[model samples]
Target: MEAESRTFADAEVNRSLTPEDKIRFLRDMYRIRRFEQTALKAYNAGKMGGFLHLYTGQEAVAVATLSLLGPHDHIVTAYRDHGHALAVGMGMNECMAEFFGKATGCSKGKGGSMHLFAVEKRYWGGHGIVAGQTPLGLGIAYALKYKGIPGCCLCFLGDGAVNQGVYHESLNLASLFSLPVIYIIENNGYSMGTSLARSSAFRQLLAQRAEGYNICWDQASGENIYEVRAKTQAAMERAREESRPTVLEIATYRYYGHSVADANARKYRTPEEIEHYKTYHDPLLLWQKRLVDEGLLTGEQAEAIDLGARAEADAAMKFADESPFPTEADICADVYSEVDEPAGDAPRGTHFFN
Candidate 1:
């Protein structure tokens, strides 16, 4: 499939969004922002355990891309998956419970913040291994094609994963088999602490790499919800209809460190840079301004959305706090599908399989 080329003329398209769509888009952004903020607080208060990666600034990409997918579509993302899970209709209470290691979690507390799963909803999981989901996404698309299911797989990966061999191999295989998969690279300029320029020898052009695989590709501004949504819809449509793959490179930024553990992020990036992005380039703020300017939402109406999101998150935290922890016996059950034979000469009660 030949890659199509299109660019958004900022001046012309800036006013193209409808009032209703703008309000809904802003709500999506706010939901993610508030959700992350609450998760951060829970992590700091020792309520949430395990690895906690905040998707603060990358809300636009998740909300926008997810908005384009139908109920039949599948989604798989990386460790920073709270926003992705929420975008796909996972409840706030269940997600918070999962983070707190409660049985009510989407993974039933087996997979914490990094491993959310909703199989019935077609939301596969939140893979913890770097670039691990690439092949799995391909397999999903391959399965769909094998069953003649008319759907696509939306796989989200960070810029860091692009350097991994799995990415290239997945792309090659996806193209060769004509799988309906849209590989979205959320390029937030850094792979952990390493910048794109330092890590990538190719100087940070992901769509160009897709071309070499003989697939369709495009780059969208991850800071803009409309751009992300529009491009994602177009790409998914083409993938489903053409039975091919497409790569969408979304240029974005992460407000927090790699995880909540990095409290002092100023060592790598300046406060000024953070302030600049937070103040001006924030996806939520950008969408809010557009909605307010278009008269779709007043300043008061937007503020209400923010307040409502915070209230919802606060309630989720309360629910998580009252939830009970998993018992020691419960741990033994999920690890193995069937009981294993005891070691030679070992007693049944003395030793148990993990």
Candidate 2:
């Protein structure tokens, strides 16, 4: 497939964003920021446990791409998925409760930091295995294509996952079958502790690899919400109308460490490098600046959004604390598939069980 001529710089920005849209974008970013900040605090306070992947800096990509997709469209992503869930309309309280391992969680507290799911909203899960969700995402797209559904599947993977064999295989199948799937490479430039340079011999031209599979491809600066929204809209449109696979390489950065426990303390990259990226390419701040410069939002309005997000996150934490944990019986319930016993698998007098 050929690379799309439309680059991120060519993406339309001024026209697509209304005042209300700008405000909503800011609010969404604030919500993600506040939620992750609270999650970090909870982790330190020993309330929330497990590997917490904070999506502090990548809010633009989440908000932008999610806004372009329809409710019926499905999303499957890697472990870094809290932003994806929230962007897809998962309730903050439910997400917090899930993080807290309460029954009120989106996954009934079964899936902690990396297993959030909302089937009704078509948000599949936060699969923990690196690149494991690629095949599953392609399968979902295949099913959608088979059913003649008008929805596309957006599969998100880290930069590291591109090196996985499943990634290439899934891309090949998706392209060959003309499946309605968009493969998004969230290139935060690290695979856990290993930098992308050290991990992959091919380095960082993700769209080029997608081209080898005959899939339409594009790259976007994930720091800019407008660029993300525009590029994703184009790719999604192609997928829906043409029933073809597309790839979007989002060059993003993570503000926090790979996981909450890391605290970004280990020195793989220089402090100067991290600071440079954070200062220049901070997604939330970029959007905030745009909104303010365009006269769509004032500093006061932005502060209010931040304050509101913090309060909302605090309320969610309280709700999760008050909520009960899942019962032991519920454990055997969601993990297994309930199907009738085949043939004489079950005794004649006993009913089938999962």
TM-score of each: 0.90, 0.91
Tell me how many clashing residue pairs each candidate has: 0, 1
Compared with the true structure, all predictions reach lDDT values of: 0.84, 0.86
Candidate 2 Cα outliers beyond 4 Å, as residue runs = 1-16, 337-354
Put down candidate 2 lDDT per residue, 1-354, tens digits, no spaces.
Answer: 113323443466426556897789789989999998988888888988878998888888889898877865899999999999999888899999999999999889989989999889889999999999999989999999899889899999999898899999999999899999999999998888899878877635866788789998989888877678888888888888999999899999987788887855457778888799888989899889877987778899899999999999999889988999999877765543332334544434533254
lDDT of 1 by residue, 1-354 (tens): 112212431323334646676687788778878977998898999987767988999998988888777866898999999989888888888999999999777777889999988887788989999899999999999998999888999999999999899989999999999999999999998888888887786635876799889989998888767678778877888878988999999999998898877655667778898899999888889878866775678899999999999998999888888888788777765543334444565444533634
Q: Report the Cα lDDT for residue 237, model 2.
A: 85
Off by over 4 Å in 1: 1-19, 336-354
Clashing pairs in 1: none
